[model samples]
Target: MATATATARAATMARGSGAADAPALMLSGVGKRYPKFELRDVSFALPRGYIMGFIGPNGAGKSTTIKIIMNMVRKSTGAVKVLGLDHVALETEVKRHVGYLGEEPHFYEEVTPAWLGGFVGKYYPTWDARLYKATLERFGIEQSKRVKTLSKGMKVKLGLALALSHRPELLILDEPTSGLDPVIRHDVLAELMSVIQDERRSVFFSTHITQDVEKVADYVTFINDGRIVISDVKDDVLARWKRVSFPLPLRPEARSASDPAGLEAGVAEARAKVEQAMRGALGRAFAAYKIDGLTFTGITCAFSEDVAREVGHLAGTRPRVLPVSLDDILVAIVRGSEAC
Candidate 1:
């Protein structure tokens, strides 16, 4: 009776919330290393109903981590759990629950969406024909269209439709918006947002486009140089990175002392130099903030003022305070690659 009850509980959990008590996905102390790059000690959990944005620079371990989770490549160390099932030990079951899209999606050129759908749809016992039909209709994808004949955006939509029709508990997409036009991208975004209407379903997509992540993802994980750098909500990351500038007094011994101007002239020169350096370094205007005895030089105005102050801490002198952007955070992380 106890064993039957436990089995029933597992089934109920899987049916209702993918994994109610357990996370939809969990990576604990996971690490994978190549000869020149490594993804080290990465860990996170995506509970039911949450979308996690996996962001990183090129050659960052976002793809590696996704591959590992998909069981495409075995992990060198640690563990990955999907829907409370061990990824390696339960590979077949986990795959049934995960829907994936790659940067360059491949389908046999001869296969029609109808045939491809028919073929892939056979694997899932719980595949929803009604949902699949609705998806095709909504996307205006014709069943007779050859996979190769479709545009890139259309193919992506088809992939998404395939994934959703299977009633997978989790959708994992790799660069789903890489090369599409803005209109297509917006459509795809809307399509993805619609997937979360179930609330128990989740999406984990990897991309370098912070704008998409900012717009759709509730949670974010940043990877760089083969490791997890920052993992938090989208707002939190933008809140932490900022750009700042300040003036150094003109002293004969100082780098700018060669100019005959007094401290006032030094301030102007310093402002210009600081602005130039920040623009060169950060690529945006520094948005200023209010603080006693503190001024931001070369600061452009923005919503990410907290980020500016945090970045200011690293300048060896706290110039002024302001907000930072996702782009600025990336720049700062890249600048201090060793810290990452």
Candidate 2:
């Protein structure tokens, strides 16, 4: 909800000029503490015209961070600036030009889409009724149908239609595709892509869907266990992490003992040694590892000649190192953080 006074002030400031050089959104040392969960020292920036995918596993503070930006939740520490304005001090004004769609947007069950649109449209001076109508039709959402009659996917489409109708400068979407079918999800992504084509607009998309992010995000920030583990350009992140697979050593036989328990102990000891060697070679950069009967798989973010040499020496040969996808990267980082 934006106030008219703040919106006027924001308009005046925009006319005065020079805001384009600033970041669309910036968070520095942002932290939030709850009784059982805490988001600590999270920091990253979304450039003015590019899309930044805010990704993490469930309960990883992704929603918490987005709430803080929207001022729905207060932060315990750090600064959050949106469109070069303080998110709190200029809350109303900042919201005037920011479009947001939550995972589940609640509406009055008795209201129809047409009525809801009129009620919500009053807040935005730039609201375009024609565009809104067109968008609703395109999504196959019946304007006369009451909110309670809509399916989860249809409700999501309605939320999207409302968010985009105002033509905001920044779009903040939290799980925008949660209940959407594949076709609708594709259309939604296409709409977001079209929005970013405007050099003055930006998108902050937070979702667990890594494939969508891989398709459109220019940058990525990954949070886990309430802390940020990676924040960088998508290309750079993809370039630095890799999946390495190698052969495990054969289990040693218990030459001195006749018991089956002794033989099992010998095999276990050999497996433990191999695991230790692999860990030692990668150090803190080791993301995740798995061992099958005769094969070992690990993910490492340290991609360099030195790392290659160390891994080779440990394996007694060159290990198979392959490029990692965004999904693989997120899984490895989350699982690895849990191991710590």
Candidate 3:
């Protein structure tokens, strides 16, 4: 549950009660250059009062993007607006209005939560000592205990408490539950759900956990290889993408697909046949197909009854359309993109 202090503080920190037209976050043509890897033209928006899951596989620039949002890592190009204010030009004000928790939160290990709270609280002009104390108690952290002796879960709690104590209008969290157990993870997610009770604050959650995103995220932005793959409402994304499975008919062309000539050549042959069979069936629906023995499993983002019927009629096989989950969609897109 969201603590009363957090909800109350969030309202107080809001830009204004009537300022709802602007998005909570907006990134335009954001790019970060590196010798080996670069985040190219990354852009997305999290509207006010919603949780936008920034999801992708490891080394997919999720952290890099978050760091840029926080102005911890300078971008090579593009603009970032947090709470309708320029993120970089007004860095101090942006930080004051946005509470952030890094993937790996660091602190002075020698100090106790009590002492560290005092030190950190001094920076945020709106920091509430009472809320910080309440959060620590709620998370079952011993205020007097040193940071070095606490478990990972406990440390996450400590970092979250500090972030929330300031009552920021936007919360930017990076993989806070990555290594936590199910129970701890549940606690963290539950807090997120309650954070936006007033429907003014927003959360930008950066993580690889598809389950966590599916559970509480209103929107999802998928990134891979430093690029935005898809960004849209979670339900819309799930509704549009689907799994189409059909039996690979026993034929000469189909037979070569699974032959031992070479996996690459065999796979290519399988895909070609599937494409030929699905020619008129697809219409406006773009799909990617793979062969696993005698089955052809295709993933399409534009699923419809007409497409399904056409697939059955043209492919000469009964094709089943199944709703897809985030995991299914992610794998399909990544594999499909890589294959191209």
Candidate 4:
């Protein structure tokens, strides 16, 4: 069972003004080495009072990165900071204000929710009995029942209750809704959104569910093959990375003297021509492309001013532009085999 333990309990939990000034979370060139898999050069930041979706496919180092942040797994290289404090050197102080909910929370089978709260509360000075009681009621958890008797969803709610009882300044969640039903999943996401309303807290949410992230996250950080892919504000990422479709170039057999340069169509040349036009429009934002008959499509990571300016020039042959979902961008970048 991998768990992130919060090492802090303050006699009085007061929000620190200085801490809020820095990023809620930061990772610099973090790396971990194993027999065959290496999580290399992972880096990104989550600003205060915002939710950052840490996204990636399985075996893509998402868990590894989260573990490094929690200090549950030692890193071979790099630095990690939570709430502006060094995660390692000031671990106890840092954790005192940090909350964590793993994919599956663990507890003693014999313990009741009330008992668990009393036990966990003793470790944190900021633990609020009233808040815990209220949260349990809100979540509809029976405090008298043994944790083992609760459904997976109920257990998740209990975990959240404990995490929020102290009103930690930061929440680090690793697939918190992995095995949950839709209703429970929705409840969890709603709680996360509510948590940051204080503006004194932030969330680092790790899950493969792009929809959840798309629905709640303010920023997005994508990872794959043990490396950082893209990390930016959610809106910017969506706007800049787009799916572009345009008419195919004229076939070589049908080309006339008036045809535009490289517009003679063939599988290879059509791709080349689209790639050329897109690159001209988006510069290095042009990522990967594909072609089939009269249809040509490409993905540009940076939707730019030039795309609008250049649209008129290729009006007759202009490709249709459409916004892509997080999944579309992820798939296109991860295993996007259509790159010319």
lDDT of 4 by residue, 1-340 (tens): 1222221222122444225577989999999999989998888888898999999998898888888888988999999988878999988878788888876688898999999999999988788999999999999999999888999999999999999998888898989888889999999999999999989789998998899999999999988889888899999999988877777664555454355443443445655655576656343556776666667666777676676446435434555789989998888768843331
> Candidate 3, 193: how far from true, in Å?
0.5
Extract clashing residue pairs from model 3.
none
TM-score of every model versus the real structure: 0.79, 0.84, 0.84, 0.85
User: Model 4, poorest ten-residue lDDT window?
Assistant: 4-13
lDDT of each: 0.73, 0.84, 0.83, 0.81
Model 3, global lDDT: 0.83
Give candidate 2 misplaced runs (Cα > 4 Å).
1-12, 15-18, 248-276, 279-281, 337-340
Put the candidates in lDDT order, highest first. 2, 3, 4, 1
Q: Residues 39-154, candidate 3, lDDT per residue (tens digit)? A: 99999999999999998989989999999999889999999998777887778877887889999999899999999889998999889999999999999999999999999999
- TM-score winner among the candidates? 4
Better of 1 and 3 by lDDT: 3
Model 1: lDDT of residue 79 = 96
Give the per-residue lDDT of model 1 (tens digit) for 128-236: 8778878888888898878888888898888888888987778899889888899989988887788788787889998888788888888888777877777877776
Candidate 2 per-residue lDDT, tens place, 1-340, comes to 4698678667757653225567889999999999999999989999888899999999999999999999999999999988888899988778888889986799899999999889989998778899999999988999998999998888888988899898887899999877678887898888889889988899998989998898989999998898998889999888788888776543445535578788667657657877787556355566777877656787778777787777777666798989999899888876664332
Give the Cα-based TM-score of candidate 3 against the true structure: 0.84
Looking at model 1, residue 69 earns an lDDT score of 94
